[model samples]
Target: MAAHEMIADDLLAPAASADPHRVLATLREQDPVHWSATHRAWLVTRYDDVAAALGNKALSSDRVRPLLEARKSHDASASDRIRELLSEWMVVTDPPAHTRLRRLAGRAFKQQQISAMGERIERLVDSLLDEFVAGGHTDLIAHVAYPLPATVIAEMLGAPAGDRDRFRHWSDELALVAFGTGGQARPDRHERALRGLEELFDYLRSLVELRRTQPGDDMLSAMMVDDSSGEMLTEDELVGMCALLLFAGHETTTNSIANGVLALLEHPEQLALLRREPETITTAVEELLRFDGPIKVLNRWVVEDFDLRGRSIRSGERVYLVIAAANRDPARFAEPDRPDLSRNPNPHIAFGRGIHACIGAQLARLETRIALAEVVERLPGLRLDDGRPEWKASLASRSLTELTVAHDAAR
Candidate 1:
């Protein structure tokens, strides 16, 4: 790849080995808004540029429409179920629809409601830790990180406890189809994703029906009745909302916990600082998120012609906001690469910005704070068993395939 060539072309290559930060920093300095021939979208890298683009009105978040349209050309029938599932996702819709969905779901994620789960979360954390603490070695992802949030979200959604593992499997397959790296043209992967979605929808529909006949004190039951304004989610909307919450609820937090722990292990000083002053765990969680958050890239489609970084971006074009790169921009963060537990005034868009920001942000933070606190406190002399941890081959979210660690057997 030549120096002047668009970086997206190389980034999309399966074997591209250049560090992502170096490539993004090069682009941020030379061409912050260069159009990519490979992705057919503009790549936004700088912190300010990415943040601004996230809130730009001209950029739309209605990603499902394009996929549905493309799939209509071949196998239109298959697209129906997928569309029904994705169209109701709050993250992929524009205003009015987005506003309504956010309003309905946002009520359940209020800080007070999330805080109430603290005791429940702590008990869950303790139960999970008990399973692996004695073994002295375990895959944190499977034993703790994945199950903690999966179980929490499952209980909140009133899903059967026995089905948590199956739900996780479906979530994994859908993630590949919905947010996998490379382009959106893989037939085999999409077929698997559609099948997963079908099965998930079937299960959720039954759960919703059960809640209708035999209402329980769960979020699903709470969302069934109308609000004071007499607005209630339709059957399709309810199912879609449940599906989105079930998958997104655990996926990002699972990665966040894994990534946060890895970041601390890599920087022993930061970990030591966190150990000495446990009160800093709150700020430490923020720093961990800033240092190595789960999400890597976010997509927004241009709704109208606009000037960005002195370049004209045409309508119908897509833009990839490299959030991971932006978080490490030196201009915005001093020593952007270093993990400082008490770094004050740290403003990172890890959960995103604007109207479409993650609604479950508070819940995720609470879970991470509790999980990290317990792990660091209970498990002494913890260290990575594998020298080289594996990262998932994904562009949507930065995740570990597995994270095995060992600690003192006495603990």
Candidate 2:
């Protein structure tokens, strides 16, 4: 690779965040285990390498511990509350702790329970669509994508419908830290996230207490029970679980719907095919996830020395697994750039792989399936506005800041 290509390969650069596919493609071909000076981490861009790294036991997922340890001399005291809460998040843990949390949280998202919510999800989608269609044009992310899953997850936790906006605000603030967004390292963003987490945790703690006294037929209530293992989550653990579910449950699903819609609008032929053959919605959702999935990158800390593609990674080093790039690797998918809604046997890792795979994968699929079907069928002449859509500059997920589309509302 040339000197300029290396200079342009900064993952944290504004241009790269808007659309990393180009840079990722170059790295995938030239240097599969490229070390990014800007990020000070190893970039794993190949399909096989990223896949193996995700399942690699040597690469630990406890990101919080390392982050706090590095900042211990500076402001670990300031971040104490948030760090404690974040360490409890299942996505940030490894091994026995993650295993226990997964076992307990798994009860809330059983296949039967998720399937039973189909009718309710459909109703929610229709209701949201009805309100947005009143206007000739609207931001799809705000009207549909964000609300559908936000409402579903909130309702599942038995949270009062009225408090949706509050938690949504909290989630948004906390996401600045959870997802690797621009300026995330700044003290203000960290402070805002800390405040948001504090408030949200307090709210969830109270909700858990209520459920403890009078259990209801909801996820929160279900989580409070002791299963075959006879292990129930402690009060703090339950609060942390609720916070993680409420945040993760909606953030990824929101981007999935928005990104899927933009991809379809960009590829008219594929959109028309889906409209003509609605039965392919299931397959379409899978393809959409592959073509332009929401999650872009995931990071892991090396706990033991490992070698890949002739590159040696030492212990305590950071590795970034580029999911978006891996999904489009030519070795894995044919015509990787194009969107083919009917593509089958598509084994995309949009929801990730391994034991830490998204716990709410089924629910996200169900919501996106229903939302896409309704949007395509109801909104005739649905097309992008003249203004170019804005993409969020984040390494954690590929998401739109907003997606405005015009449609034939009269129809």
Candidate 3:
């Protein structure tokens, strides 16, 4: 490897991007943590190193500055600027602010609170899947990916049932804009995403006022009674948090469900095994997440100088954990590339680990398990229909933009 490396172009274009397993495996085998000028971040491919980075709070998720520097190296582009604007959502915030906001939001996503919504999620998934049967041809992502989490988060936010489609549209734009293609921020797409977020905030702003006057079962009501000082979230924080949950909640799970289904279809033996033993659903879900996780990698900017993998990473430097790669690390699991539900003690960071572990993982697991099981049970001879699937043009959020599948009815 040269001292100054040219980031591979296969990585630049989403469709042309290297198969994540191959890239991760190569990095783990050679450079566990190597700085690539292309991405402008120290990419950590090894499991131990990736975990260490994810667990380090000293490394902030507030990435505006690092992104700024990365932009300087390039001639500048739409995608780069687009990423800069998406720094508002809580997912990008660092503590004590991140801690404060996450704690407040946790009130709404408590295990009991999230669990209580399961039956409704089941109904939502089953009802939509019912449509797939009647239509006989459906893009699982368009039909299911965008809906389940959209409806789930909307219900939690107390958004109007009529606005579900609108919410989905906005959420999709926001998700894409935030995770838009590599190099130079994509301005147009970024604006489009933020515009949707602005609209969502307007809706939530009014809802916040209403909650103040007359609280309801919605999470908005809970956020009003801030744990600290027993005061409600400031109007800005309230809107920011709402934007975060509605957007992040939907974005994270959508990819997992889409990616997980793709994995199941690709691995016929495991899919059949899952159908034979429904009890293995949980393990199967974990395997799918481990096999092809939703949140591929996490970003971090070093706040203080520290030694990482024998390399002298200075303050204000960038470090990224290639989670997708770590999950497939051979040392971490046997036959690392193989998707085996029988693989025990499979602890992978599909939802992430430590402070930022996905709060809604349990819900995501349930949504994925039920939706996948229903597909396997309902869609007969369901297999990848197209010669190749088209991947979303995003390095951060790995997903299929279109997955054509062949299917028949089970008589």
Candidate 4:
């Protein structure tokens, strides 16, 4: 296909391929701000353009409007419920609303609070590894990557331990809604996504009510009380924030762990480097994030007419910032295609940039750091079961459906 055709086609399908770097690189070079007829959004591929777009105040982050419009065409009731649920998400809002919501939830995710859970995370990692270490072979995603963050996030929210699996199910279904399927035009997928959204919202609401009556030493409890400014979150906003934390909390981290492991296994030298210089675990995690971050694309609507790279972006037009592409942009990083654990000054916007950057970034880094460190330390002989692994067909985020690995049983 021609460059423009490829750019205009369904970007998600090609992105799910084993290697999308070439396609992204081509677009970044040919047309950094090419409009996609397939997705009906402008594709911003270059690192500079993506970084700027992420921080551009002229680009509104209120995605709820478009989503509501899309839902309205098919299901009115579902749209109304979604609007109420998403209206309070800091990520989907702009300016004053986003500012207020971010401030209120930011306290609960403070460094001090997240850091205190380090030992707990470490123990959790150890226990998880203990369960599968003797097996010699297991699906890493199921045994470790998925459970670690899911458990931690559930505990942090004071959710019952028994309900972790159900949370995972809700998260998967909601993911289909948040990140469209390859065939979003299909009505069945839309219906399923809406069902998932409703179920997730109902579950979160019940949890919020429980916290209100019997608060505990958890982030949700912390968020319920007044802050230093004597401000409190409304019920809708509270549930929205909790849902955001619940989904965003585990989903991205789960992908990061799985993707990071895959990257390390593919590059044995880098894996060995990590084993030798364990201190580099920090930088290694950063490199892993840069190499293959979970989030692939983020959408922002143009609030006003703006000229980007000599092209005029009119108001109300959607812009899909290809984060995975930008991370591989040669203009920003040296040897952007290669995964170098020691690569410093890595300014990759994997988590995003500006005021709307990921709030749980520190926590994610902490989780990934601990998880990777434990993997290298405990399973020194670990290796991929097969050279080929399947990638989840997701446009918004990159993830592995499963990752099988084996280590020397004696080890």
Candidate 5:
């Protein structure tokens, strides 16, 4: 709608980043599978199309070339950088290889493993809330949401807990790199971001290598020490996956917690609804994700000619699935706009759908639930000081920049 949101074509689409559903809904009604010359692809807004694209194993997530196309076929070097930085993670990988890497990550975050961390996660949430209690008021993002997920990632990766604070800095900056913050479309800031990422990878490699010899009770250890595989893992793959996990897992959940807090504070009816009916936490989390989803959009390159609802797309064509918009699809959710915490069959694509569904979704749910429950219980009358929340812009990921609030001042 505005000049800046015009960047919504950047994949992250900041213009639509703040309440993008409005724009997406219009697309769903008009073009359903309309092509946005801005994004240089077919923008899939309808729930069915978004679900189809997400489930279409044929549509590849690795879109370095499409990015070049989006850039008006400018520089081959930029194409390489986009492919190189994105190719390592499972998000950017394809088929058989993606399966294996996902399995490896799955082995590390196996349900059994995540289930065991329940108490630890609860304690972590409590400790974070303790700071809010001590400080009277806290910037939920800085003090809690941001740090907790980063800490969980460090633990998962077997990094020292003490480094969690600095890890937050690295993750935040790295996310800016992902979003190309400051409009770093060229080499300058882009190269620096990659360099910083390499440094992070270097640090993770050291730990991964150590786990090769002296193992710990962490995820990196699980991968390195997996006896079932009877094969050693590659360092590049390991670092890539970990870096992705940090960016994907940490930031998304951080945003979820921060955004969820703001939503709950503003919606006292929902806040009391959760407290009086704690069982609603599960459904409430789903609504929170829909109301303020962490991951707003997912992109894909349609490999083969495909039929999206009715619109047609040719091979090698690109498509963008507006998840935030689809979640509010009127056909899918009655009064799609309304944030009904108790909405049943909340079938939302917020965590995405199909093969690339967020691997850390359960972890995100655990983190957000714990954080919100703790905040509500500890901070009385926890409400947003500002009516409007500031959102972050990026190539991927959607979240609040800050969540200032005032409470009962209970120490």
Candidate 6:
């Protein structure tokens, strides 16, 4: 299909999911600000455009709140709860509110706290790998990628270890809606997503109450208590934030680990370099993030008229800042398509950019760094299984459905 003929679903196609860099590169070069008739959104592809759009004040991140007013009718009220919770998310709000929420939430991700988690994360990786390597062949995602970050975030939130499985289930359900499944209507998926949202909210509300009564040093407790400015998060806000944290915390990291491993395994030279000089894991992780990161497209609504790359973007229109495309933009990085473990000064916005940049980025970086090091150290002979890897049909994020691999058992 012609680049200009690109529709919203084009990005969600299985082929696109498997190799988005190729598809995005075409759009980036041909039409940086291509309009999608089906999605009713402008897809900003180039590195410059995406970087600019992320920090652009003309765009508003309050996409959820707009839906709240538009879908005010009785028929739409059924999903009002979903929209209400989403609107409360710090990610979907503009200044003042976003500023306040981010400030309060930012406390949960202090540098010291993240730094301290290294040993604990190391222990978790070792423990998980113990059980993981027992099987000669296994799905890396299910064994390591999915559980590592999930358990870490769960423990931080004071969630019971037994409830980790439930979190994964709920997260999967939420992904269907959160990532915009192929831009196709699926009532079943929407219902499951709503159920997952409601269930998560209810579960978090109980946790919030418990933290309020018998607070601890956990993140949820930290969020509930007053900050240096004596600002306290409201109960609903706390619940919403916790839900967002749990989902965002594990989901992206899970994808990063899986994608990072897949990238390394594909590029044996890079993998060998990581094995030879383990210190380079940090840069390796950054390169892995840029090569195939979790974030794909971040949504924004144009609240004011703006001209971008010779295209006019009017108010009340949706804009999709294609991070995947931008990260691979040849104009920004030398050899943008290749994966180089030692690539320095990598400014790829895998976690996003500007005020809405990922709050959990440091923690994610820590988790990924530890997780990749352990995998490379332990699974020395690891290699992909015979069949092709499956990529989730998602537009908002890049994720693997599964990554089955086998390693030499003589370790």
TM-score of 3: 0.90
Q: In model 5, which runs have C-alpha deviations exceeding 4 angstroms?
A: 1-15, 64-85, 179-188, 226-232
TM-scores for all candidates: the values are 0.92, 0.95, 0.90, 0.92, 0.89, 0.93
Alpha-carbon deviation at 279 in model 2, angstroms: 1.2
Predictions in order: lDDT: 0.81, 0.85, 0.73, 0.82, 0.74, 0.83
Best by TM-score: 2
- Candidate 3 per-residue C-alpha lDDT over 184-284 given as tens digits, one digit per residue, 9 for 90 to 100: 25545545655666677778788788888988888888777757557456887887777777766786787778888888888889888987887887888
Clash number for candidate 5: 3
In model 4, what is the error at residue 115, expressed in angstroms? 1.3
Task: Give the residue spans of candidate 2 off by over 4 A.
Answer: 1-7, 71-76, 135-137, 182-187
Q: Kindly list the per-residue Cα lDDT of model 4 for residues 1-411, writing each as its tens digit.
A: 655666533655745456667667878888888878867888899988898888788898888768678768677766676676666678888988888888888887772388788999999999888887765547989889988887887888888888888877776666656445333455666567678877877888899999999999888888898988889998877777777877777779988999999999999999999998999988889999999999888988888899988888999898899999999998899998899999998999999999899888988999999998998888868888876788766667787878998887463
Q: Give the top-scoring candidate (lDDT).
A: 2
User: On residues 282-373, what C-alpha lDDT tens digit does candidate 6 reach at each position?
Assistant: 89899999999988899899999989878899999999999989998888999998999999989999989899998989899999999999
- For model 6, give the 10-residue run with minimal summed lDDT: 176-185
Q: Ten-residue segment with the worst summed lDDT in candidate 4?
A: 177-186
- The per-prediction tally of clashing pairs is 0, 0, 9, 0, 3, 0
Query: Which lDDT tens digits does candidate 2 get at residues 84-142?
Result: 87887999999899999998899766723898899999999988898898744489999
The TM-score measured for candidate 1 stands at 0.92
What does the lDDT read for residue 290 in candidate 2?
A: 88
Q: After superposition, how far is residue 318 of candidate 1 from its true place, in Å?
A: 0.8
Ten residues in a row with the worst lDDT in model 1?
9-18
What is the model-wide C-alpha lDDT for candidate 4?
0.82
Report the alpha-carbon TM-score of model 5 versus the true structure.
0.89
Itemize residue pairs with steric clashes in candidate 6. none
